[model samples]
Target: MVTILFFGQLKERLDTSRLPLELVDGSKCLDSVAELRIFLQTKGDVWKENLAYGSALVAVNQQMATEDTPIKDSDEIAFFPPVTGG
Candidate 1:
């Protein structure tokens, strides 16, 4: 299973702060960050735009990671809007 955490607008949009997903063959994994973006796109147009434009940031196991970051079972993934609190 993969633990997905949502923050800020993403959390409000998904109506939840966290979700646990079963890792299936085609499911989002460490090496498939793009796939995860696609999955989020399916949630709505806002997600599609945000993911496509890189408006959000993704983290794996508390470290920032690119879309190509490899994922594994029991991994923890978090998503948050681009930081603007400077």
Candidate 2:
């Protein structure tokens, strides 16, 4: 099972705080963050825009992660917007 967490503006935009996916032999089971983004797109325009590549921050198990970062069944993944400071 994979635990997906959304934060900040991302949560508001997607109207979701958390999502859990059970890994199995199907499309829902993703290998990497890139694949996850593509999968999320299937949800519609809201997912596609919020999860766009190079647009959001990703973390795997509390550590920074990239688009190609591989995920495991028990991994805890989080996504959030890039921080901006004035």
Candidate 3:
């Protein structure tokens, strides 16, 4: 299982702060951030919009991650809306 976290407006927007996910058997060997987003998108239209590519920032095991980032069981993945400073 993987631990997925949502932060900032993303959490409010998705109405969830965290989730535990089990990878499907066949896809376990090569699961990635992109695939995770796609899976989450199935949750609802809110998730589909909020987790869309380039809509939020992602991290794996607390380090910045890209779509190709590999995901493993027990790993922590976080999603946060992009921040800007004035």
Candidate 4:
């Protein structure tokens, strides 16, 4: 299982902070962070909206990550809306 945390507006929209994602059989993980987003979108309309919107920021292990960043076991993935404070 992989740990996924939601932050900022994402957390509020999702109405939860964290989730555990169980990889499907035959594979221990997904290909990359973007792929994970696609997978999460399958959950429901809320997930599809928040995760598939193509504008959220992603971090892996606290480091900013691109869509193609590789994902493996025990990784901590986080998603947050684009920062806009000024």
Residue range 1-86, candidate 1, lDDT tens digits: 88989899988876788988766756434346667767767778866775564778999899998988877788899988988875
lDDT of 3 by residue, 1-86 (tens): 88999999998998889998887756454399999898899889999999999899999999999999999889999999988999
Model 2 lDDT tens row, 25-81: 564468898887788778999899888887789999999998899988989999999
Worst lDDT window (10 residues) for model 1?
25-34
Tell me how far the alpha carbon of residue 76 in candidate 3 is from the true structure, in angstroms, after superposition.
0.1
Candidate ordering by lDDT (highest first) = 3, 2, 4, 1
Report clash pairs, candidate 1.
Answer: 30-69, 30-70, 30-71, 31-70, 31-71
Task: Note the Cα lDDT for every prediction shown.
Answer: 0.78, 0.88, 0.90, 0.85
- TM-score, cand. 1: 0.79
TM-score of each: 0.79, 0.91, 0.91, 0.86
Decide which is better by TM-score, 2 or 4.
Answer: 2
Task: Estimate the lDDT of model 2.
Answer: 0.88
lDDT of model 1 at position 20: 87
2 or 4: which has the higher lDDT? 2
lDDT of 4 by residue, 1-86 (tens): 77999998889988989998765547645869878998888889998998874668899999999999988778899999988877
